[model samples]
Each structure stands twice: as C-alpha cells, then as structure tokens.
Target: MHQDLITLKKICKPIENDLKEFQLEFDNALSSEVRLINSISKYIIKNRGKNIRPILTILSSRLCGEPTPNSYRAAAMMELLHIATLIHDDVVDDATLRRGRPSINKVWKNKLSVLMGDFILSKALINMVRLNDFDALKQISTTAEKLSAGEILQIEKSITRTMTESIYFDMINQKTASLIATSCELGAITTSKLEEDRQSTHSFGQYLGMAFQIKDDLFDILGNESDTGKNSGGDVKKNMWTLPLIFSKNNMTRSQYRLLNKLLNKKRKDGHILKKIYHMVEETGGIDYAKNKLDDFSNRAIDSISSYPNSVIKQSLVDLVGFNVNRVK
Candidate 1:
C-alpha cells in the first residue's frame, strides 16, 4: 500500500502545485467555531484521507484544459462532501476505526461527530455557492440527494437474504458513482464548451466509480482487514448482503441455505457463524463473479475516455481505472 501511494503520487506530480493551492483553500474555508467544534473539525482534517476524488477532479480538468480556479473549488467541494459521508458512514457502520485510526464517533461522541459532518457538508455548499456556478450547484445537489437515497436503500436491504444483481447495481450507483460522476462533470464544465465532452466525462466517471465500488466489495471478502483498514467480513457480520454473498447464496444447497439463513438471523454476539459463511462465499464463485463485473465496468470506463484527445492526463485517468480494479487491499 505504501508503494502504491508512492506510485500514485508520482502520477499526480504534474498537478502537485495546484493541489497545494487547493489544500490552502480548504483550510481557509474552515471557520473558527466554538473551541470544541473547531478542535474536532481540525482533528478530522488532520487525519487526512486519500483525497482520491479531488485528484480525479483536478486530473479530469487538466485532461480537458489548464487547471482553473473553478477546478480547485470543485476539488475542494468534492473532498468536503466525501469527508461528510465518511463521518456519517462510520456512524452507520458502528465503525470504531477509519484510515487505520479511531473514527470521529469513536474518539468523540456520536452527536458531536454527526454535527461535525453537518458542518463539513455545509461548508462544501457554501464554497459552491461562492463559485456562483449554477450548474455545478445543481449537479452537486442532485448527487447529494442520490447519495442519501442510496444509503437509505442499502439500509433497507440490510440483512435481507435475497438481494438481486440489479438492486445491487442501483445501490452502488447512487452511493458511490454519483459523486464521481459529479466530480468529472464539474471538471469538464470548467474547461470544455462542448456538450458531448461534458457528457463523456460524466460517463467515464460513472463507470470508474462502479468499478471502484465492485473492487471494494471484492476486497472485503478476500483482503486483509489490517491492510484495508476495515474489519474483514464486516458486511457478513452486519448481515448486510453484498454481491458476493448474494451470488454465493444462490449456489448453495437447501441445507446450506438453511444454515446461511440461521447464521444471518442469529442473535449471537460472537461472529463464528458469519466466518463460516464468508468461507462459503469464497468456496463458491462469488468473488470470481464480482471480479468479472469489475472488469466490465473498467472496460466501459476506458471506452468512455477513448474519445478524448490523447494526453498524459487522459492516459493517467485510464491507468487509474486499472489501479482501482486491481488494488489488493
């Protein structure tokens, strides 16, 4: 993972100077609130995330034309929105750790964490309004709504035994892909005048985002919890039916299905039965099926960007899809 981040840094070097400006912009945007809230917000920023979404925004903008103020603002907005979601996600997952550290809710109380999330999200909108870009505002607002809807859908489906592939796609599209699409669209809107270019960028982001989420689902089943900074088999433990579990369950015998149902419905605190179910998912072709789906999405992402004039930035975007799908952790 260290080496991978290094490689990503090398790839993003061209935009390094611009990213610095964005960091400053983001820092300046965070106002000094009451001492406790300010401290919590600063703590959240100190444990900085990967900043992948913002990188995508900047890189996509560079792919189309020179980096502009709008690109930086958009990147900052994307990062703020992403951080807000992470804060909320930790609460929903009852997650104790994030990015290999204690989560905000774990360190502080849940109420404080929730309010911090709201603050960050409000700051993002305030920045967008400052940009005075109506289209950007509309796109981000729509994506935020979709993200909330996706979360609700996932919560609604949690613990259910029969999650269809289509429903899974829908859930991921709203939860993960919508923000990515907005990032790319915002990038294109910054530079490109043609409607087709903007549409293509949006499509590219959507495909890449889908591929990214599918890969993440695969990793949860097969990856090291220590490396991913997430508890392995969390989906199973929470009785949340992901794609792999769904595919594996479809192939189970009636007796196996009964065991699976019993396991999912179990009220036990310990996760022994859930571990067995994860092993079952591995034994079946669940992980393999997800890999194939990831490949399909990656290919679609490549196709979406094929129309762009060949440039280093465009090539980097293509390479990023490959990286996202093949990431082991």
Candidate 2:
C-alpha cells in the first residue's frame, strides 16, 4: 500500500472505535431478506474502499462535538448514496471494473446492476428517513438531486462536446462535492447544532471534494489500472472531457485541437490515439494546471477549518486534505 493510504489509517486512529460502530451501522443498513441482495451487499462490504466519507462524517462530528447514533446512521446513508452512484455510473459507462474488481454490471449485467443500484439507493433513503432531522433531510435530499443532475449534465456535455472548465466544476460540485459537503454538515447537524460550525465543515468538505475529483482527473492520464484500480483514460474513451483536456483545448494550436477533437469524436480509440491525446494535453501543461488547482482547493479546504481549535480530529481533517491530493489510488 502507498504511504498516503497508511497516513489515512493513522488519521482514522483517533476515531477507530467510532468507525467500528459505523461499520455495524453500515452493515445493518444494507441487510435485506433477499438472499441475492444479501450476497451482493456482503461482496460490497468485503470489497469496500477506504471508507473516506464515513471517516469524514465521524471526524467532523468529533470536531464539532461528540458523535451520536444518528451520526453513524448519517454516515452510512452518505456511503450508501456514494455506492449507489458508483454502481449506476458503471452501468452508464459500461465499465467492467471498480476498485480492481469486476463491477456489479460486469458480474450481474446492466439490468441487474441498475436494479441493485436502485435497491441500495432505497436503503439510503430509508436511513435518511430514520434520521428524522428536518435540516438533515433537506440537505441530503438536495444532494441526491444534485448527484443525479450532475451525471445527467456530464452526459449532456459529453454528447454535445461542450465541456468547459466552468461546466466541469459545476458537474463535479454537484456530483461529488455536494455529498462530501453534506457528510460534514450532517455531522454538525447531528451533534454540534451550531450553524456556523455546520457551514465551516461543509465548506471544508466541498473544497476537498473538488480537489479529490481533479486528482482523479490527473490519475486518468497518469495512473494505470494496476495503481488506480480503474480503467485509465476512461473519460477520454467516453469523450467526457476532464480538467486537463478541457484546460489544454484552448492552449493547443488549431490543427492540434482539430486532430484532438477528431480522435475524441471517434467511436473507438486505440492505444496510439489515446497516447497522442495524452501528449497533446501534457505538452500544453494541462497536468501542471490540474495539480495547481488541486493544491489551491486543498488550501481552501484547510482554510475553511482554520478557526477550529487544534486537536487530533482537526489535524485528521487537515491530514485528510493532504491524503486526498497525495493518494496513489
């Protein structure tokens, strides 16, 4: 494992027991009578990623105050929402793999994948209802809408080939940042009951998530499947323009831009074409541009929480910003 990932483990050390309780809550949230649903849920749990969202929820809660049972439920709800989106995204993208394993769509086909995604989403909704906090319900509901709208907007931009830096940010904000923001806000809502604290953590999570997605954009070009556990250059393959390609488009010459567009418009791109596109973006300094933005957002995230008193939880939140930008996968 990468040292950054180890750093994440250390960051979670402060809330190790809370995370354990969260795991139980998460497991219970996914429990169903249907055998197949149970099997798939088990697989998802077994193949879970870093549990970053839940960590954020728990940490944000601690930073503002103590975590309550509702905080764990909120955390589980956030993760279930994220997982549902990923399952649906794989089906939409026709992706075969996720986190270095065959995707749900690949294993069970798109039809089943779609239904399972719906099932998981329903579970998320159930958790949301159980929260019984009007403020939290509103926040989570808005996030759900934004998540769907973000995906639709991305698909629209890709089909129209009209992706720009502005649209890219808007897309990521809705699709990714909104959830993280809610995770932090929900933590405050469940515990702190202070609007100022809620807003602080929300802003922090929003900036961190923006940095997170940009890092994913960089990984698409620079990272391989073995490292990223994802299909590299997937955005290019799907003609979904990301930050690097979007930033580079204006910097390239007319001919270079035309050639790049031509390749992107193709129904299929071979290794050579993908390599050429990567070089075009690289030569125009797209990679560096993205890294700069990643750092900018990371700093913004840290700044959002600057007023909080120094403590292990606060330091973990700060470390999380670094981990998000530095993680290899």
Candidate 3:
C-alpha cells in the first residue's frame, strides 16, 4: 500500500523530458573558460545527487499553469546556489565524503574547494541576471543569505549545546526550507505571475522541506552507512543535537540528563556511546515526537496545494509527500 521514490519517480514522468532542459541550463551555467574549473565542474556534475530542487521547480510550475523557459533558468540558479553551499559546507565541516564519494574539498583541498564554491556562486548570480525575472532573483538572493546565517547559527548552537525547539525549527527553516520555499515561489511566478498562487506554492515548498529535513535528521541517528551513505552518529560527531536528541534532553531524568550531557561533551563515539544516546532518546519519546512533527508538516505541505485543479503533475507532488513520509534512505 506504500510507494517508494522509484514509484514516485515513475508517477512524475511528465517532468522527465523537461529535466533535460534543466540539465542543459545547469551545464551551461557551470561551463567555464578555466580548464581546471571545468574539470572539477564536470566531476561534480557526474556525481550529482537527485535534482530535487529543480524537480520541485518544474512540478510547482506545472501545478500552477504551464511551465515557462524562465522556470528552467530559475531551477538552474537554485541548484547552482545549492552546490555552492554544499562545497563550502564540506570545507567547514572538514568532511571527506559526499554522496558516497570523496568531496571536492577532500580531493582538491580547502583552498581550491573554497574558490570553486565562489565560482559557482558567481555563476548563479550571472544566471539570475540572465533569467530577467526580478522576483525570482530576489527570492533566491534572500535564500542564499538565509543558508549562511543558518549554518552559523547551527554552529554556534552546537558549540554551546543549548538548542531549543524554536531555535532548531528556525535553523532548519533557514538552512533547508528557504531554498525549497523559494524554488516553488519562483516556479509559480514564472507561470502565473499571481501573488496568491506564488504564496501557495511557497507554503507547499516550506512545509515539504520541513518534513524533508526532519527525515534527514532522523537518518543521522537511525540510518546505516549503506543506507545514508555516511557514518552513523555523524551529527553527534559534529556536536550538533537534532530534534530527537534535544526533545529527549528536555524530558530526560536528572541522572539521565547529566550523563547525556557528559557524553555529548566527549563528542566522540567510543564503545556504546551511540547506543546509549539512542536508548535515552527513545525512552523520552523524542523519536515519536519528531515523527509526529514530520507527519504534521507533511500534511500542511499537502494542504497547501490541495486547492489546485486535478492533474497528473499535482498528483505527482502529492506522491512526493508520500515518498518523503515512507523514505528509508
């Protein structure tokens, strides 16, 4: 009775051909005169993950009306900005792997990685100008700003180890949801140019992104390397406490809280550290609470676009929500 991403991808086949259009724009955006940069860019392209942002852009455009050329341009800009952020994030985290491969920062070292990220950002800006859509440009620029602020805030919180529920939501909203929200808004504006339509799609994107990020956080604690393509308890290593651990902290017994705090300060997974954290978090109902929130946010995302007319694209967006709910990887 449940459909996975493979099924959802099949359902969204309407967007398949247009995805090629997005790829062309993306390839053009990353093409550089510098040979080294071009090689790195090609490598990045070859190892790219799911183009969820662009897919959202295309689907949102169709849900509102017919997608336009500007939609592809906007999608390219969003993805470029996203890749730039990921490159910088890897450097900041000193991450060695990304999507199961050596990160650019890991392969090329910090200096070139940093410069490559800047180059991608500059290209995104150039593409934004070429799009000639002032509204889309504004949304994307604001999202770019939000991404930086979110990472800084998360870093600050991780060091202090004092993240509250409100703070966590705000952090994820900026870091994850902002671009998704803007992606849908850009799509809507590209097709309709209507304020209400754009707002609806933006809301849909924000809520879906919220659920998406919560799923990622869950995977940090519960997933295996084979499933997540990363080490288990990576968040713990990073000193970042996600929603489940934080909520559990709030409800933990005094002895449990102190022990948890001490373990977190160690910031290294020795024998049984992760198992202890998981046991304590589950005892306090944090995982269930987070799951409830995931459902709540996914429902809101669904409601946001429920008013749209019946169409396969709309159904595909709905299927995406279902896929997010049931996703294991």
RMSD of each: 1.7, 1.0, 1.9
Off by over 4 Å in 3: 1-5
Off by over 4 Å in 1: 159-162, 268-272
- Estimate every model's Cα lDDT from 0 to 1: 0.82, 0.92, 0.87
Which residue segments of model 2 deviate by more than 4 Å?
none
For candidate 1, the TM-score is 0.95
Candidate 1 lDDT over residue span 1-329, tens digit each? 48668767776777898789788878877776579977887898899877888888888888777778888988999999999999988887888878788899988878987888898898998899987878788889999999999878887887454568888899999999999988888888877735776788899999999998888787666665688887766766677778888887888788888877887777662556656767777787788888888899999999998987888788888878877875655
Q: Please identify which of the two predictions, 2 or 3, would achieve the higher lDDT against the true structure.
A: 2
Of 1 and 2, which scores higher on TM-score? Answer: 2
What TM-score would you give candidate 2 relative to the actual structure?
0.98
TM-score for all models, in order of appearance: 0.95, 0.98, 0.96
Report the C-alpha lDDT of model 3 over 173-226, residue by residue, as the tens digit: 999999999888888988998999899999999999999989988888777777
Please name the candidate that would achieve the greatest lDDT relative to the true structure. 2
Positional deviation of 71 in candidate 3, in angstroms? Answer: 0.4
